[model samples]
Target: MLHRKNTKLINKLSTALFLAAITLSAPSHSKPVKNTSSPKKVVPAADLSAEDKLFVELREAAKVNDVAKTRTLGSKLESHDLSDYVLYYQIKPQIYDKGAQARVDSSADAAVEAFLKVNAGSAIADRLRNDWLLVLGKRKDWANFDREYVQFVLNDDTQVKCYAIQSRQAKGEDSKQLGHELKNILLDAQYFGEACPEAAQGIYRAGGLSKQEVAAMGRIALENNYEGLAKKFGVDDPIADTVKKARTDPAQAFREFEKKEWRTGRENTAAAWGVIGQFLAKKLDRNAIKAYRLQHEAGHHQLLSPESQEWKVRTALREGDWRLVKESIEGMSPAIRKRDPAWTYWYGRAQKELGDEALAKETFQALIEQFNFYGQLAREDLGMKIHVPKRVIPDESLVKQMSENKGFARAVRFYDMGLRFEGNREWNWELRTLSDKQLIAAAEHAKRIGLYDRAVNTADRTKAEHDFGLRYPTPFKESLSPIANSIGLDSNWAYGLIRQESRFIMAAKSSVGASGLMQVMPSTAKYVAKKIGMTNFKVSELDDMKTNLTLGSNYLNMVLQDLDGSFALASAAYNAGPSRPKLWREKLPRTVEGAIFAETIPFNETRGYVKNVLANASYYTALSSSKSPSLKQKLGMVSPKASVLSELP
Candidate 1:
């Protein structure tokens, strides 16, 4: 089902790309017909304009894999910006052909060289070069790989980095240097794919990796539910095996885990039990707290991994046990405890909840040193203002200079032709070379061009000279505020969520079919529209500013009331659905601090959504009121729903 959905999305994007190309080829004043192809007055291929004819024939040739025709048509593409891309397409398939390796390598090298010669400093060229490098790495062509590797601007690919390490080792480099590089990439659990695993194996063979390093890698895999990865690294044991089983069926896994005679190792056994506890926390199993207590009672509390301690925190929070929450947090490794702001904030909240006022205030004061989501909440707790940084106005001269840049011009053209994704790539590629000041200038240009979402994102890339205005622009003020007001919703909160949901991209549609600034799903929109007495509502209306705002606000308000006016819970419900949050709340043994409840949310997406929305709302509120807003008040205690309501939205 997932594969089918992904394929459908790919087909949709492909169709959109084709339509965009046709649109771009046409005159500016021409009306786009419903049927893009075979339009009412189609021009003959010979009669088509030069650029249009080249593009059309080149696409047709590539579609049929007519390499000869592609090269012929591509040669006539003229000295234009797209010529290199056309040539790349002409050569791309040959690189992947099941021909002789030397021939394939030669073709790929030529393609990279030619493309870079013409389209130097372009994102498309970089992408093509990366693809070529992958082929070179696969074929073990170190000479070509070494030559191209240094020129790879992004250098962000883990696989490419792995190959580079492999290349160095092939050149008789010491294993110590190779091991140093491998260790850095190994810790990034996000990319434990073939390249890194192979690199790890190579490092292990050379005595570069220790037993603890291998186990740590395996632990990361188990924690992230990737058991096969642990197996691939040859770090498997009963504990790791039990962790995998727990992910699928916690009760069955636990029953089997405990049946073995105790004596393997205390730490290993506790680690296995901890994985089960984490699973139980995710499933909200009734026995989660009991299981955690049993593990602790067996004197293995010192061996509990960060994941195990995290679940212990969740299990305690479910019952609003402040003492246990503090204990669980304290039990975690100091490194883990110090790094996670969520845990830091919760520890303070737990102290406050348990009547340790001075300690709570001290914790929050220390935690507020970093300006982040939790810092905002800490400020709210301390009654301090949430300061929106002064807007940094870009200089007109710099903005003008960026406006006339060739890359910027091409990006704007792509956007004009409705190729948003392509336009974004072009825009970001240019941004890579810009300083913070230049990025701000480009953001101002994006705003002037009415690409508000692009403007927001462009400004967001800046690390210094914080510009809150560009980051949190209220594009549809008149429409959004009134709708929010009518529904008795917080205008700041409404806009905050909209900003995150769609980045204020009014016509944006999510991959899942949710549309407009609020990203309301079709069914949800329809239901809300009807409930609000919108008799003539259509799914199409969901993309309109007034309609989407009204419907989305109403739905938000409905969930807010349904969940007892707890904004954090309501925000989670808004993202995940009303039913899941409702069920998740019911899993709680008692009322828990709202921030703790939010951090413990099972769905990563919803947990992030809630936190970001609240944080955004805090900033937006500060911007609007010229005073601090209380994120603490927004995230009030979240008790379980009074009773389960069978009827749901």
Candidate 2:
């Protein structure tokens, strides 16, 4: 039943090697060395203007994904007029990266790993959870865990690989020794013809083999099972007795496992069931799964009867079975009055449906006030209009829309048209969810087209929110605060643009080839690379500190000049491409808000990008303790009566 995903992995490996090769060959274009200058010292914390210090520290903490420092610093920076990049990445970076720092906490990591099945990739079936890797490691460094894992994989050359596996052997967790010896034992057992190469002698010389430990481990599914696993490793039955005993008590074992308080046996059984689900006799497996799925689907399983209906409520809520979820929860016993912090939202949902309007309002109000994404969802269900993911990655048609059609290209046009028309009679936001496009690509397409409002709203609504915002918030700030004053470009406003443009993601790429922290186009980055008299530059590494900031700030500085020192015009130029923003002036009937007013902008991405920056500037202002720059300020809409083009020198 083990439907191995190994083949797909091989294909991906091939692609990665190919791309990495190209990236290496193209070295001259992306050598990120900005100057001959020494790495600048971070400014004296003593000299930072108080608000700048708070945000800088928050930004510094976010560089390493330090969540605690972010929260603490955010509390202090509350008065700074800064951008939301501090919150999106600084406060919660993984929410965007899908938690890809490859770090984790123990309990939550276990839950997420259990859900993910594979250790890591794009998070799917991945629930939001606090990392648990550190806790599971008892606060040990990940390198320790990596070392243990490496030993299991590469036992030979052990001395070169690491310190002697003396510790694991002494602790009797000698997986490396077992894996190495077991492999030799296996090939010898399965010898068809050729002699086997000597096994990689491990750092841990296998001490007196513990037949008992190997026997005990053999049947437990530790995967490192020394004897029976040797079957896969090609080992002869050193002790068939262990397998015999386990087989004899299989039913009793299942029962006993079901009874374990820690639910260990239940987990073993679930894995067995999962294997069965993958590779069983078709008729038998289908029938069993059909029965199980039917029970779960019909709302009639022991997992959720009247007495234990709360589980059913949670189950339905988790799967978003709204129609039945509300009914099931409300029907639960009145005795089950309280809810866990985790379960409180379901209670609120039930209350809303029971028409207990006031109580429902209060419960949800408190829920959202305390939590963020889900609370936002509940508040919106109460007519507050918060963004939430439906948790469905596009099935197929959406993939087609992004990959096969003019879907991505058209999306930009449609998006621009929509944003320009937002708050106008023609702006229609909901046309997209039904448009058979992946929301991520669709949002980018919207940005390309100039539907600023639509792009912002839709991007934030989907699980792909960061896809649109990832460019600016992430790498720029990480490197920005560390070297901002020296690198220059008001860090406060830089943070604002980073937040406003791509929510501060260095790697965020629009549908167009606008790349890096500042959304510099790939061509533009190439030119910047040449201008600074440095050679190597990989497009992907644009998120790296020195190159991204150097190019980004220079671009910003140039835009500022052309825009007559107007941050709004510069930002618009940044979004629309500076030349286009400038040329559009003579081409379009100028509104007071510049040629590309929210309603008139032709390129969707620049249009929405401009507005988002303005909105984000307001939020950033709130965070950075700077005066919130008004919308008119961003759109060149100042003095609603006066035209910017008329004032242009």
Candidate 3:
């Protein structure tokens, strides 16, 4: 996930931090082991030995495709403790080139094979195998790909899976099985990179899949705005053009569509309508309801993807059309309606509105114990409050065991060097086989090391035991609470936003320049500082704990006041600017429950952000007060905006 462009910034920060800090001694160990009793001392990269520094440099160099530098640094660290990773960095560029044709150096194959043989069963080796498989896959080297893929421990990459399917087809494998596998991979349209589309086309050409099936996949891709993918499936020439027109001017596109007869058949026609309806629904336009209605009337609702089907329901939710909501949800794939709690809850609400109380109650009961935003709302619908599971503490010996884990130590080293992608991969690889107790202990270790993000994520993975303290940590409560209180903002809400924004990482910086705990944009920070009368404020201070908390809290309070104190609206505004939420509220046909509004948020990120912030706030409140929290009270109602906002940055 870490891109080449960001490597420079990461390197600068890592280098400065390394030079400024000291390393602490680690426990003696032969091989990287699992779990610890006490917190292992963190070693700053600056204090690491020459070999360790070279390893970090090698990682940095490899990230930016500096092959020469990477090879030099890697050679120096060949005898280091984590030499495998160094070797991986050295060979990775030779096999994998992003956005370029796969060109494997002649020596890379043998070198990678040797490395994989030596570090077999290790995470680093598996990673190298994965990279090597990609190259082999691109070259249509089925012999190498088939061999390496069988040993690939984590078959999680979409592109890799697509390549495997291609390999299977090349070897005259069962068409039915390959088609089924290709369908599953193609359905993940958001990540539909080059490989999957190519495979789909190949499978279709080879009579493994039908034209209509491939077209449907293309439609799904178009629903996700993947025109390139749609083109690859041979569905873009006419349908993609209509979808593009619909995006720019839905009403006009609808008129044009109605006036024309398609040679592409009912499926493509329905797909176009579904896409138009999806775009219009995001704008809160009633025409979206009409578009979907036409699609349904044509008996082609089945053609719409799960996402488009959900948008049809969202459009109805904004219109308070319960009948349409029920109908749209019914048209969705059973897998979607049954799997997504949002749809189930909304379906229940629709049933209740249609006087089907028994069905509604059953649906609400099913979600009462889910412990999410929808689950909380479902519980409230059943006349109950949010319940926090009792905390389970891990033993000190377990914590000590986690601290001694070499994988975690490597993860910590990567984190110290600002390489979160590698750090997260290392941390998660170690967590694969951990028990509930071990998970809690790992989370505790992460918490002690100021890896709050890792701590929260690790605690969240526990299946049986729970720990609210680790899950909803209030790291800077002493400083954050006073600022929130002084600014008339709920401290719990601030904590939730901070937790979601930066996970308590003091030096966290977003892609768009939002910095520090609250992830405040530089522009927004400047505006807040000017408004709060903080003279001579510098943007550099946005990374300062006090400055970030103060400014972010003030901005949040401003949005809350401007938006009629609706937490859902204010939370959405905080994530997606103050103006967009106002536009969303103004376009609403009628007042709706806060949960409905949050669900219908146009921006996917903001929609999830609002729900998470509110949910996290509820948990924080419950943890702090030792009482059941009222999530409904926190969500309140979201009505049409009064339109009084004059200036908000």
TM agreement with the true structure for every prediction: 0.79, 0.28, 0.87
Ranking by TM-score: 3, 1, 2
**Model-by-model lDDT, in order?**
0.72, 0.40, 0.78
Candidate achieving the largest lDDT: 3
Ranking by lDDT: 3, 1, 2
lDDT of 2 at 32: 25
lDDT of 2 by residue, 1-649 (tens): 0112332443333323322322121111222232211122133246456666666566545544454456567556433433222333232333222232222332223223332333222211111212222221333344554443332321332221222233343356655555444332321122211111112122113533333323222223221223433332122233233234223443333334334424333323333322222121111122223222323333322112121233344334323345455565454433342433334565676567666778778777776543232353455556753322233433454534544333233233322222112122112223334432355555554444444444555555543223424121223355676545664555656666766655444445565667655777777777766765658877776766567777777667666765667666677777766655565444332233331243234454665566555545544443444453333344454222222442211
Q: Which is the leading candidate under TM-score?
A: 3
Score residue 311 of candidate 2 by CA lDDT.
33
Once superposed on the true structure, which residue ranges of model 2 sit more than 4 Å away at CA?
1-478, 482-484, 500-505, 510-512, 530-545, 587-591, 594-596, 626-628, 637-649
Q: What is the lDDT of residue 236 in candidate 3?
A: 39
